[model samples]
Target: MKTMLFSILAALLLFVPNAAAHTYISETTPQDGSTVTENVQQVVLTFEGKIEEGSTFKVIAADGTAYTPQSITLVDGVLTGTFEPALPNETYTVKWDTISQDGHPLSGEFGFTVNAPVEEQVIEKEEESTEQEAAPSVESTQQANDEDAEKSTSPLLLVGGLLVIIIIVSIVALAKRKKA
Candidate 1:
């Protein structure tokens, strides 16, 4: 029985290719760990799989500052999101979550560094008017954030819950068999 269980688990893991593998950043605009001489107007991230059309993508800096860009654009299977303005010298983190053509919501993160200072980065997000914004609602953004957190939680809890139930059932069944 143990061998059979192991086999099933191995098979499941094999067939279910890491959902992470299905979507990956193949090439980034700044590239990983690259030091940029000039300021970058956008933090473009290109993925291995095609992002679902009209999906929301986001980039967050390592210092916990998020790039609320002007807009996110998809071209020829590549996702390029334009930053509100160029950022200053510091380590910036890029995070993205989007539904793939395969229908799975994929999300991941990476970081890059810029040599500039903070003041330059601060002005970009301010260029846009808070009142006449064309971006998605804050409510929708919050909902997506909640869903992303849940995705990170569901699989672990599911496996643990299943294992607990299986052990309990096996113990009860064995006790009954011995009594008989």
Candidate 2:
């Protein structure tokens, strides 16, 4: 009887490590903090281990609207979720929660930005082509350039001023710490 008990204990110990394996995010589409030019129709995430059922995926717009799909499917460690109506231009946060095969709960969030769409880019290119054909006189061209320069100066100054202020604050903080 003691021998049977020892054998059972050894078998259980061998299986414990395999059941406790951790699942992690292996890859993600649109990558964290990246800007995508194309309209996003779906979001894909690959995991290192099998994802269990009852997983949740969400895409939240900058305006705080959450986009949840009807269902999330996990196949061969890859999770695919399709968004209805597609995603528009904005900064979006993708949040996911799932249980790994080991029964561990995993959750994480990532952000990405969507820029102008393909159609808008094509239209802008056509407009630029027409503008170049109807080139303005030298005087008007110079005036437009001057206006653009004036419009761009204020923002540049603001950014530069902010950088200078940050540097000054950093130096003062470090000097006080040194004196102490």
Candidate 3:
């Protein structure tokens, strides 16, 4: 019984950490619900875990324009989808089915809006104003964080489950040995 418990605990420790590192979007480049005046060049997704190459990231505008960047990069654990000039003021829905470091394909999206055209604002405030505006509101961003937590913690549950399975198998073996 003691040996079986030890084995179960060992399995939990071994498998739980990787499950905690499952793929999730750490942050979005534009962030949630930010009104922008200029056209965005790309949508960058910084993932918590390493993503497999050749996975797809996309932006679908409220205007029904599905813009996909021809190029993708997974450098230093960030997945970037470089786009051309963005669509007009509208909500953008980003989606992806990327392979996680643990070899699972994860997919989700958060929203952002380009409120103003960037060109006119830049032309008007062309004072080279580098003023960093106040941070965007964050109520919506919480959903993305929730997704991250969900991905990272799923492995813990898996570990717990595997531990139970091992414990059961071990108990059965011990019972059989005692009977014999």
Candidate 4:
């Protein structure tokens, strides 16, 4: 009976730390794997618990350029970081490394694409067709518009779908860990 009691106590002790290992991200600005039409000057991540001061956030552009925020401020479990002017039409990944309140290190990476404005896309196409012998017909322009819309929306749908799957899996894993 003494041995059984000791075993139970040991199991409970081992499970406690795992349960409190890290704080979960309650929400984030721009969301994970989303596309923003407007300029994004900053990234904000909100956690369910407090984050330590030593936490770091990084922004990496698709061209292999990495940027550190000009400022990082933590207030009421929300960490906000300001960066330079909006990145042009490109995908960027925000990588974060932070210590949870429990002292465990947690890190994650999320991506967002900054899409060019509709006017900008139209201007670029106009410039590209400057050398053409004939003006584009109305039907051809309509078809091009449809194609562009499809191209832009397809990636967003894929990314959104993947994010949903990830969130569902994470919730299940967390639930199981908490139950343990």
Against the hidden reference, what TM-scores do the models get? Answer: 0.54, 0.55, 0.60, 0.58
Number of clashing pairs per prediction, in order: 3, 0, 5, 0
The deviation in Å at residue 7 for candidate 3 is 10
lDDT of candidate 1 over 1-180, digit per residue (tens): 564465456445544533442444566767766666446667666665677786565666777877767877887567777654456567777777777777777776666677644554344345445443322211100101333446655775676567656666666766787799
> What is candidate 4's CA lDDT for residue 24?
55
On lDDT, the leading prediction is 3
Candidate 4: worst-modelled 10 consecutive residues by lDDT: 135-144
lDDT of 1 at 164: 59
**What lDDT does the true structure give each of the candidates?**
0.60, 0.66, 0.68, 0.65
Tell me, by TM-score, which candidate is best.
3
TM-score of 4: 0.58
Worst 10 residues of 2 by lDDT: 135-144
Where model 3 places Cα greater than 4 Å from the true spot, the runs are 1-21, 118-144, 158-180
Kindly report which residue pairs in candidate 3 clash with one another.
36-115, 37-116, 37-117, 37-118, 38-118
Compute the lDDT of residue 176 as modeled in candidate 2. Answer: 81
In the range 13-111, model 2's lDDT, one tens digit per residue, is 434323236576766776767787765667777777798888778999999998886557789888877764457789999898878887878777777
- The residue ranges of model 4 lying beyond 4 angstroms of the native Cα positions read 1-5, 11-21, 118-180
lDDT of 4: 0.65
